[model samples]
Target: MSSTEDTTAQSSIFKDCLARRVIAQPALSDTPDASSSSSSGSDLDEFISYLASEVWETLPSQLRALTHEHPVIDVDADALSLATIPGSFTDTLVSYGIAADPDSACDFLRSVLRDYVDEARAPPPAWSSTRTSECEICERDVPLTYHHLIPRSTHTKVLKRKWHPESLLNSVAWLCRPCHSAVHGIATNEELAREYYTIELLLTREDIQKWKKYASKQRWGVRRG
Candidate 1:
């Protein structure tokens, strides 16, 4: 038996699915898996395939041809743009009859990809050094993030306290991750500084409560347009 024959005999029966193709990795430790490009809510591969498939509509001859060659391929964040939509992708879209203007479809894909990239790159929000990890307002056992009671942008005019490095962190409120994002979404920095600066004051706002309720329904960070 030759080397090729020996290798084929030894290799585990190959499966068409991704789990078979990917090198079995240890469960991610302390960080998310960066190797896979797929995202939970928005699937890039399926979207492209759907556009090319006959199930949606008949694609143009050119796009249909591309389906066989580049059915699904991984694209990086930098390549997610109107200018960068590969020829194969454009062909696939046209073949599926989904391309009214190829540029329009490309723009939509870019926006969706940009959203995913933003999520992947987002840094964890920081909390005030003075406060414990637990939220000061909701008292939930969640990740803590700092809330600027006076809003850091106010620093442009004058310092809220003595200008130590931790001065801003020291002066801020300790809030749960949800609450911190909620507070900023509802009220502008000026409003937060002038009107709602304390737990009692912030908790009473109807907007904050509404935001909290809205956030609870979302699967991730916050529901955005």
Candidate 2:
């Protein structure tokens, strides 16, 4: 078999082995071994740092330009807060890449945070209906246009790698027209612009679902009276 085919076969086998092991494990809520835990944590940090660096490198030139315009602050502390937490970043990393092991991935992320704490800056605020009028890129009120946090180009580039549509949307943001133009370029490329709109439509579905849940809660609340 070809090298690619061989690799795929091996990966499938490994995944099957892991699944079986998980099924076999007894429920253990007790504390884990300290040394093993620490070692695993360290591995996670290394993996996170590697992944973050890859992401940074993969960003579009326009997006990178914006970051360059802004000052870089220590990100280690914030990274720790985001990385250690059992949510978005951790989930994204694991889903995007087949981590060697889960515990090791977690630990490596922590160490990565520690190393880059000083270099990290707070991300720009998210854009929503309330924030749409404001420019996300420049924080000004200039006919803001939604900018994809993860550009369509980037998404397409990474599509070959394992990633879900929902995870892709979670990684993007909205920006103003000028800022969007500035980041992308002055030429109005209709096709490229359309891709962004498509992603927005996908994200809208999420908003609608949230609204539906909220409305259900409100209706239930009223019915309880």
Best by lDDT: 1
Error of 2 at 69 (Å): 34
What TM-score fits each model?
Answer: 0.37, 0.22
Residue-level lDDT of model 1, residues 1-225, one tens digit each, is 453442232121111011111111122111122123333312322332333332112222222122212333233423345554556655654554444467855754443333323332335443333334556655654456667787777555334443333444336777765456456655677777666766778878754543333233323222111
Residue 79's C-alpha lDDT in candidate 1? 39
| Candidate 1 worst ten-residue window by lDDT | 12-21
Q: Write the per-residue lDDT of candidate 2 for residues 38-128, one digit (tens) a residue.
A: 2333333333333454444332332223221256534333333433445544454455443344554465444433222211222333433
Q: List per-prediction Cα lDDT, in the order shown.
A: 0.41, 0.35
Clashes of each: 5, 29
